[model samples]
Each structure stands twice: as structure tokens, then as C-alpha cells.
Target: MAFFCQTDSYATELLTEVVSCSPAQLKTENGGKKETLSGYNVILKDTVLFPEGGGQPDDRGLIGEVPVHRVTRQGPEAVHFVSSLLDPGSEVLVKVDWNRRFDHMQQHSGQHLITAIADSLYGYKTTSWELGRQRSFIELDTPTMTTEQAEAIEQLVNQKIRQRVPVIVRVITTDDPEFNQVRSRGLPDDHAGPVRIIDIEGVDANMCCGTHVANLSDLQVIKILGTEKGKKNKTNLIFLAGERVLKYAARSYSVEKSLTALLKNGPEEHIEAVEKLQKSVKTLQKNNLTLLRDLAVLTAQSFKNSPDRSKIFSLHRKEGDNEFMNIIANEIGTEDTIVFLTVGDEKTSGLFLLAGPPEIIDQVGPRAAKILDGKGAGKKGRFQGKANKMSQRGEVESLLQGVLNGTAPKEE
Candidate 1:
């Protein structure tokens, strides 16, 4: 059935009777997250709220005093999911979210314009389209479009908008001659209403059930942002229409201003400035790694040169990484002294490594890692893996100490 929206896209409010109301399971969005809800499924005699269909989304509005979060098509009825139940025989004000309604209207009709123009000029049939939150895209059967071709298409679309072409909806039955004339992908098996043909005056007409603007001028302007690769070797033509174009322009200018301040350069030179900054960052990182290596060597030497010459060495660096830890372990000589090296926050997650004799590393490495709430693997007397709780390093030190003292416990 053709809902009120398909018939009059501009109508924002209607006084309608609640035909039926029943308890049902529902989903409502809270702060952009969906939650399962227990609510009333209200069937209104008539509604301005459009159900989600035809690649367009459902409408959000009010049914009397209750907020209608969801509306869906069930056969010929538009089901309004609401928090409060309205009496079956009572009349209620069904108000459409006009801003959202008009935005969808603009994009849905804008799609028609794009589809018609693309097909007429390049014989590129629109396979499908999506009305995304940020931008909309229509997938064309063609593989690609050149810069010149895309420009020509966008030029023609805006030209038609400038011409202020009237967009008229025609309702026709199966027996009507125009029924066979309009372009259609095909109708649903359950489609029960007269076919809708949206005619863009002197442009084109196609069979569609979605809501649209009354005129091309209502679209304001359509900006074909660019094209992207699509599945099946098709091309998706991305675009923004009406207020979206204005919004995008405003956001882009804002970003440019912020970049100019942060980069200390005009928009024209921002790219070069960013490139130079990136190169400088890379050089600094290289120098930092070299310093870490030098520190690792000196630390290992401190252990070797000490009078005690400790057999079990334990070290943790909050700023170091796996590479730094490995360098220290390698310099200490894994043949005799057992080295336990960790790099990261002492009380949180980080990497760990163990180095010692073949038999000792096999036994102590995995045990030490487990004690530190971690895991590891060993080969040629070297074992390393990640640890979640670096706070247990002391327990691991005691375990290694027991091994050095020949008092380690037997494997379980």
C-alpha cells in the first residue's frame, strides 16, 4: 500500500485513529546504541511516519504524547513502536520528524536524478543505492568513470536543479499503458498497491516506492564528491545533496582553519609542512632506538662487572620495548646468568623475556611468565612473550632465586 509519505512527502502531521495496540518486543536506540525493549506495537488507521523501505530508512516521530522510535511495514499497515499505548478507538496526533523526513526526501529524490542522468548519458544503469549518514552512493553497473566524464555528469545534474524541474508522482494500475513504460527493477511479490512512477519533468521517470521532493529545486544542489570501487567491478558514485552539501562545506572550512593554526602554515603549504614534520619525527625515533641499545649494553655490563656477579638478573624499564629487552638479554650471555627483562608499566601489561641455560630456561622461563600472569616459548635457551600483570615480577624473581639455589620445586 502507498503510505501517506509516498502520496505527500511534505506532510509532517496527521490526526489518525489507533486501529489496534498490543504488547510486543521492540528495540529502541539510546545514545546511538540499540536496546531490546518491552513496548506497544500500535497500528494506526493512517500515518505520516514512513517505514524503512526502498533503500531509505524509517521515520522517527511522535504518536500522540509518546515518542515513536520505530515504524515498520507489515503487509498494508504501518506499525508504530511506542513506549505508551494509545486506546484502540482514540484519535492521536501523528507528527513526523520533519527535518529527518525532508532530508530523506532530498536524498531519495536526488538519487532518482543521478540514476536517470547516469543511464541517459553513459548507459550506466544504477544497480543500487545507499543513503548513508555522511554521504550517499549509487552503484552503477559500469566499472569506472573518468574525471571528465564524472565532471560532465555532475554539471548536468546541477544544471537540471538550476532549471527547477518539477518532480511529479504518478499512480498507475497494471492495466494502464504507462505501467509497462516506466523503468523498474521489479516489484515485490507482496506489493499490493498501484505502481508509483516518479517523473522528473523532461528528465526521466522510474518505478519507485520511496518518498521524494516536489521539485528538483528543492534539492538545492547535488555535489558528486567522487567515485569508489564497488563489488562486482561496479562503480559507486558518492554524493551529498541539499543541506548536506552546505554542512560538508562548513566542516571542511573548519578543518582547514584548524590545520592552518596547528601546522603554522596556509592550506596551500600544509602538505609540505606535514611531510617535513613527519621526517623529523622519524629521525628522532631512530635516535631514541640507538640510545636504548646503548643503555641495554651498559646495563648488561653493570651486572657482569659487579663484584657479586649475580647469576639471576631482574630488570624492568617503563619506557623500553621488546627490542630493548632482547638487546640486554643478548649482551648478558645466556650461557650462565639467567636474565629476566621486562619493558613497560610495572603494574600493568607489557612484554617479558628470559635467557639462561637450555634446561634452566625451559623450566624457569615458562614458570616465571606464568607467575607474572603471562606466557612464553623457549628455544636455544631464550624465551619471550607478553605479560598482562607486570606487578608480579617480584614473585618471578623469587622463583628464579629458588632455581639458582637448587631448591626449585618439581614440575607438577
Candidate 2:
């Protein structure tokens, strides 16, 4: 059955009766997974809302006061998914989201025009197309596109829009004589109604089921933003049409304004300013690393000079890394005194290193790994890795003390 939106793309509201509302079992997501659902599948007697079909998203609107989030076609009927149940045979007002509907119409029609022109003018058949949230892409049966070819195509596509070419819709049985002449991309396996032929007068005739603008003028404009390499044997042409192009311009200008204010420069100098800022950041990072090394050496020297230093030493630093821990371990000379060092948030996770006698290193490494909820490996009296529970540093200290007192137990 031809949906009301497909026949009358401009209609935004319709009065309809509910045919059936059944409890939903599951909904299909990406990867063919069916998740448990919490909604009812409603079938309207007639609907103005469009179901997701032919590379177009389903229309969003309302069935009475309840919002209809999604609509899909099961065979010939448009199944509307709604949260609240509506009684069968009861009348309800169906409303279509006009902005979304018209946007889809503009992009779908614009894609048809581009596909038709590209195939006829350049012999690049459109293998597929996408209706993206920001920009749409048309995948053509070619390896690459040049700047000159892109400019020429954009110019010609807009010329037709300027000429206000009429977009006519014809619904006919599949066996009609005219059906054989139109550019058909094939119909759905469950298609039950007449085939639709969207005719752009004097330009092209394409078999499409999605909603479309009444004329090329309704598209407002078509901007070929750029092209990208698609699959091994194809190229994708990226473009935005109608309100999307306007939205793109608005967002670009807003970003430009913010950048100009932050960089203290005009749009022309923003790129150069950003480059200079990045260079300065690199210099500061180099200077900071040098300071951290100096601080690590001084910290180790302070521990070595203390007269009352214990054989087992523990230290924690908030803003140090693995390199800093290794430097302190080397400076303090951990052959005789066992050292426990950590760098990160005291209450969270960070890097840990234990460097001391080989016997204790072997015994305590596995125990530390379990306590810290992390993993590590070492040889020649050095064990280090990430520790998720740096907050459990006390438990690690107790285990190391057990090694010092010769009371550490052997695991079976």
C-alpha cells in the first residue's frame, strides 16, 4: 500500500482510526540483535507518517497524545511503535514532524538529481547513497573524482534547481509499459502496491519509494562539500542540501567566531595562531619533564641522608610517573633497603614499583598484584606495573614488612 506521506509529501496531519495495537516482543538493533522491548506495535487505518524505507529514516510524530518514536513496514502495513496502548477502532489524530519530513524530502530528491546527472553526464553509476545526520554521501562506481569534475557537477546540479524543474510522482502497477523505461533500483521483497516513478522533467525518471520535494526549487541549494575514497573500486561524493546546508553554514560561522575571539585573530590567521600555541605547549612539556627528574633525584638523596631511616621505606607522589619511580629506586640504592614507590591519586589507581632484595621481590610481587587489583612482571630485583588500588598501599606495606621479618608465607 502507498503511504499517505509517499503520495502527499506535504501533508503534516491526518485523522485516522487504529487498526490494531499489539504488545511488542522484540526490536531489531545493529548486528541483527533483538532486544527485549517495552512498547506496543500500533497499526493505523491510514497514516501520514512515513516508515523507515529506501535509505530514509522513519518519521517521528504522534498518535493522539502519545508520541510515536518509530515506524516500520511489516510486509504492506506501516507498524507504528508507541509506548501507550490505543484501543482498536478508536479515532486518533496523526501528526507528522514537518521539519524532519521536509528535510528528508529535500535530501532524497537532491540525491536522485545527483545520481541521475552523475550517471548520464559522467557515466558514474550510483552504487549506493546515505542520508546522514549532517551530510549525505553518494557512492559512485568510480575510483576517484577530480576538483574540476566536482565543480562542474555541482554547478549543473544547482542550475537545475534554479530552473525549478518539476518533480512529478507516478504510481502504477509493476506490469505497466512505462515501468521498463525508468531507472529502477529494484523493489522491496514485500512491496504490495504500485511502483512509484519520480520524474524530474527533462532530466531523469527514477523508481524511488521515499518522500520527495515537489520541485527542484524546494531543495533550496545543493553544495558538493567534497569527495572521499570509498571501497576499493568506488568513490563517495559528499554533499548537503536545503536546510542542512544552511545549518552547516551557521555552525561553521559560529565556530569561526569563537576561534577568532579565543586566538585574538581573524579567521585568516586562526590556523597560524593554533600552530604557534602548539609549539609553545611542546616547549613547556620539555621543561616540565626536566624539573620532574631533578625533583626525583633530590627526593632519593633526602631519604639516603636521614640518620634514622628504616630498612623498609614507603613513598607516594601525586604527580609522578614510572620513570620518576625508577630514578628514586636507583638513587636510594634498594639492594639492602626494600623500597615501595607509587605515583598517582592516593584513593584510586596508578603505577607501582618494588625494587629491593630478589627474594623479597619475588615473594611480594604476586601478593602486591592481588592487593592492588593489577598485574606486573620483573626480573633482577625490579617489579613494576599498573595498580588499580593505589589506596591499598598500606596492605602492600604490611606484606613487605612480613618479608623483612622473615614471616612471609610460601604459596603452595
Candidate 3:
């Protein structure tokens, strides 16, 4: 049923009678796993806790010393999901989490103010709005918004906040003449009875059921962060209101300070210094790759003078890339020589490569990949694939050696 929060937005606690309480099960996901939790659905005669509605999240708090995890509205009843069931017809103390409630109030009210300003000044209708935990967004009908336009809207909204205008809530019948004057997304088809209208003094009057502060000054400030292109021709404007704006500013300042210290540059020069460092790192990486290629060639040359030069050579390199292995294989491969190479770190997965005579690869490539639990194809005497089970590297090397020595069953 309708509650005190619908009319009085500032109410944080209410002592009400429990209408009903029933056992319920809640299914939730945690860390990619689905879990079923046991709880009870407790309905109160009147509640201060606001149910999740109209893009705003539900309020969380305690009911008679038991934690209320979720509050949802079913028809006119507010359902409180708690761990233990309360007796029907018993009185309970309902407390709303003030921090969460106030944050929501600021963001939701800020959205209405911004939306009204956008429509009034630029004729941009708000298509949708989302009240997020730390940030909020309103999707506009327009495809793009200029930086200057956004700044103007921010300035205008903050000006209203400075005026400290009263935010009044009024309830009126559906047939009331003033109903037509109030702006709204429009009433639901099934909605009946009185309509709650929120009026910002000398600013806007809209039909909304969400809780809001008594005055615009309670919002403290509003910041329009940026905008992104949304679906079709819509533009999503990101913003932070009230204490969230302060929190974001503090976090950003801390990050900037750390970045400046680490980069050994002032705030304005940090970006330039980081760009230069990145370029130097890229150059060093390229040089290091060249050195690795040269080292691979030298390693291949060292094996050239080996007295036991077999037709099939199996090499295991713990510190080299696929390119390095390929270079070594290309340098040492002959018409009859088959080189089986694997390279990777001990802690993670590795790569496998088979290169040499086309006939040998065609016979052994697929078989090797299958044994290593990997997938690949061979063409023009080269086959390469990833080895999923890195810990089996030693076994893979032994299997290759066995195949080469004729101790293991050879591929047909």
C-alpha cells in the first residue's frame, strides 16, 4: 500500500504493524556461481523504506533488528525480504539506510532538474535515465551535445541549487486541472487515484514518486562529467551529484598527484611525459626483439656442429617466444630435418611448433597437437599451436622424443 515515503521524503524510520510475513527463497549470483538463499517476505502496514521503482534502486535497512536485503513493490504492497519471518499483525520498527536514501534523492532530483533545463533551453527530451551507485546518466533524444552546451546546462542547474529553492511534493486527483500542467513521463495505464507531483520553486513541476530533499541546497552541487554516443541517435550524459561529486573530485586529485610524482612532471606535463616514456619503451622493445632474434640464430648455429645431428631434433626453450623458436627452426631445418620446438614460462601456458620437411609435418603435426590437448593446422612444412596444459610440457617433449626414436607408436 501507499506509505509515508510517498508523501514525506525525509522520513527515515517508522514504527508500523506487519500485515503479513511468508517464507521465500532468493536466487542470487556470486562470483560467477548461482546460489539459493532463504529469506522471508514481510509486508508492513506503513514503511519508510522505499521500494525499487522508476530506475531508482531499493532502500536497504533493518526491520525489527533483522536485516532487510531487498525491498520490492508488488501491486500496492511493499515487500521486505528479511532473514527471519516476523509475525503477522505484530508491530516492527522499520529503519531506512539514510546514506543510501539521501544519495538516491540527490541523484534522482538532480536528474529531474537537468532534464527540465535541457528540455526548456535546447528542446532535448530525456529518453531515459539511470541512477547508478557512484554516477548517473540521462539519455537524450539528440545524437550529440557540444561541450559548451553541457557546461551551460551544468552552470544553470548549479545556479538553481545556489538559490536554495524549496522542493514541494503535492498529491492531486487524476482529474485535477493542474495535472495537465505538470510534466511527467505519463501515468501508467493501470495507475488510478491521486498523482504525486514534485514542484521545484520557479523551476519545474513534474509528476514523480521518487524521494527528494526538502530544498535544492541539499543537493550541494552537480557536475556534468562527459557524454557518450548511445544507441541510434541518443546521447548519454554522465554526471555526479551531491557528495558523490566531492568523492569523485577527491579520488581524481589523489590519482593525479600519484601520476605526477611517478612521471616526475607537473600535472599539465604528465601526459606529455608519459607519451615520451611510452615511445622510448616501444623503441627498447623493438631493439630487445632484434637481440632475441640474433641470439636465436646463434643458438641454432651452436647446434650445427653437434656430432649427433639427427633427422628429428626436439628443442625445449623456457625463455623464448614463438618467433624466436620459428627463427631457430628455419635456420636449422633441412629437407629431411624435422624440428619440434616448445617455448614458455614455468608458471603459464606455452606454444608448440613443428617445422621441417612437409612430409613429416603432414604425418606428425595433428598427432602432436592432439597429445598436447591443443588445436592447429599445418601447411607448407610448418605447424604451430598452443599447449593448453603447460605443466605437461615435459611429457610432451618426451612423447616427441619417443616418436622420433621409434619407441612410441608413429602416426600413419
Candidate 4:
């Protein structure tokens, strides 16, 4: 059935009677699972709420004190989902959420203006458009759009808005000759009856059923955010209209102020200051790495001269890495020596490294990793892996010692 909002877009509240009310169930998918929701489906004799259709969201509001959570069109009826059932043939007061309705109207009308201008000036036909909560986008048939072309279209659209052009809505039969002139995505297969056309003064005339403002000036402003490459060689033009544009501008200003204070520079100097700081940090990191390598060499030299150095060596460093442990093992220079190293702090999982003769590594490497509940692979004589059970470092050391003493099981 035809809705009152199709013609009287400014109405917010209606005194109507309920034609039918029945218990209803809606099925929806959540996290890859299907679920059913129980509610009452109410049909009103007249309503101001716009049902979900034409890429626009449904209008939400209260119906005689009970909240209407969702409104959708099924066949010829506008189905309102309510928590409780309303009495059939009972008189009711239906109110639409004006803020949400106006926002949708602004975005929908702005999209029509943009789509019309793009086609008239550049021959880029609009394939689709989406009216989002914070922003909207129109997909063009072209593969790409240059910055200059987008700016020019934005300028032209704003100029039309400044003209305060009248936005006229008219219902015409499908047989009317002017119907062919109206730019439309095309009527639905099941659509019948009189077609509604929106005429923007001398600018555009298009077939649309969505609510729109009475004048172009009601859009306040239209700001083109940018464009992105869409599926199948199409360009999606991102834009914000009316109140959304103001909200975006305010958010950008807040971020700029925060950056200016944190960087100790003006807005224009932020990039240069950040680049210089990054270069300085890189230089310091390089120096720190050189010191770590030198420390590893000195530590290995001290261990090399130890009189108690055995065929199998077991050591644990409070805060060392696999690279440091490997360097130390390589410096030992004894072909028969084996090194079992665990390095980390009390707060972290730490790492384990086993470097030694090929025969010993092949036999005990996988066993050592199993004790630590980790995994590793060995090549030549080195094996390394992360040990998530840091407190079990002592257990790993003891297992390696058993292999050295020939007490551990041999790999058969």
C-alpha cells in the first residue's frame, strides 16, 4: 500500500487506527547461526514511519507509548515489529523519529543531486548508492575519478544548493510521456500504479520513492570526502551532507589540536617534526645493537677460559636473546662442546637455544623442546624455539644434562 510519507514528507505524527495485529516471528543470522525473534506485527491505517526500502533504513519511533523497533514492507503492508500486540481497529498515535528521518532525507536528496550532476557533466552513470548513518556513497560506472573532476562536481552541486531550487514531487501514470525522461534505476518487477518523480527545478527529474526535503537548501551543505576503487571498475564517491558534515569537521579539528600540542609544533609542521624524530630514534637503536653484540663477545671470552667447562654446558641469562646465546656458543670454538641456553625475564615466556654436535642435537633437541611445551627444528648443530612455560626452564636444563650423562632415552 502507498504510505503517507511518499507525498507528505514533513509529517511526523499521525492519528490512525490499527487495521490488523498478529503475533509474528522474524528469522535473522548472527555469527553464522540462524535465530528467530518473536514479536507482534502491527498494520496501521495510516503511518508517518517510512518502511525499509530502496537502500534506505527504516524509520523508528513510538506507537501509542509502545516502542516500534523495526518497520519493513512485506507485500502490500508496512509491518511494524512491536514488543506487545495492539488491538485490531483500535485508534492509535504514531510518531516518527524526526532526527533520523531528516538525516536520511538529507543524504538521499544529496545523492540524487550528485548522481544527476555526474551523469549530465561527465556521462558517468550511477550504478548504485548507499545512505549510511555517518556518510553516504554513490558508485559510478567509471573505473576512476581524478581529484579535479571530483572537486568540480562538488562545486557544481553546492552551487545548485545555494540557488534554493524547489524540490517538487509528483505522481504520474506509467503511460505518461515524461516518464521516459526521468532518470531512474528502473522500476521494480512487481511495482505497479502511479510512478513518483522528484523534480529539482531546472537541474534534474528522477523517479524515487524515498523521502526528501522540500528545497535543495535544506541539505545545508555537501562535502565530498573522497573516492575509492569499487568492485568491477566502479568508483565509490564518499560524501557527507548537512549535520554529518559538521560533525566530521568538528572531529577533525579535535584531532588537529591534540597533535599540535603533543608534537610541540603547528599543524603545518607536524609531518617534518615527526620525520626528524624518527631518524633520531633509528640512530639510537643502531648504537644499542652494536653494544649488545660487543657484550656477547666479552661474555663468551670469559666462559671459554673456565677450568670447569664440560662437554655439555648449561647456562641461563636473566635477559638475553637467541642471537646473543648463539654468538656465545659459536665463540666457544670447541667441536665437542654443547650449549643449552635459556634467556628471559620473570615477566616473559623467554626463549631456548640448544647448540652442539650434530649427533647430540639430533637426539636430544626435540626432547628438550617437548619438556618446555614448545617446538623447534635443528640444522647442522643449532636448535631454537620459544618456551611458553618460563618457570620450567630448570626442568629443561636438567633434561639436557641427563642426555649429556647418557641417562636419557636414545632415539631408536
Clashing pairs in 1: none
Candidate 3 TM-score, C-alpha based: 0.88
Instruction: For residues 1-412, write the lDDT of model 4, one tens digit per residue.
Output: 4698776888998999999989988776889999888889999987889988777889999899999888987766788999888999899999999999999989999998999899888999999999886889999999999999999999999999999989999889999999998888888777878888889988889998789999999999999999999889999999999889989999999998998999999999989988998999999878766776787788778778888867767667775777878888888753788888788863357788888888878777888887777788878888888877667767766776777787866545
Q: lDDT of each model, Cα atoms only?
A: 0.90, 0.91, 0.86, 0.86
Candidate achieving the largest lDDT = 2
Cα lDDT over the full model 2: 0.91
Candidate 2 segments whose C-alpha is farther than 4 A from its true place: 25-36, 301-308, 330-337, 355-395, 406-412
Error of 1 at 334 (Å): 3.1
Predicted candidate 3: what Cα RMSD to the true structure? 3.0
Q: Candidate 1 overall Cα lDDT vs. reference?
A: 0.90
Cα error, residue 41 of model 2, in Å, equals: 0.6
- 1 against 2, candidate with superior TM-score: 1
Ten residues in a row with the worst lDDT in model 3? 391-400
Positional deviation of residue 406's Cα in model 4 after best superposition, in angstroms = 12
By TM-score, who's the top model here?
1
Task: State the weakest 10-residue window (summed lDDT) of model 1.
Answer: 185-194
List model 1 lDDT by residue over 1-412, tens digit each.
6877778989999888999999988866889998899888999888999998888899999987799978988878889888887899998999999999899999999999999999999999999999998899999998988878888889999999999999999989988998888888888777886888999998988888888999999999999999999989999999999999999999999999999999988999999999999999999999999999999999988888899887888899998888898888888888888998888889999989988898988888878788878878879899999999999998888888998898878768
CA lDDT, candidate 3, residue 64: 83
How far is 51's C-alpha from truth in model 1 (Å)?
0.7
Off by over 4 Å in 3: 31-34, 188-190, 311-320, 334-338, 354-383, 409-412
Q: What is the lDDT of residue 346 in candidate 1?
A: 93
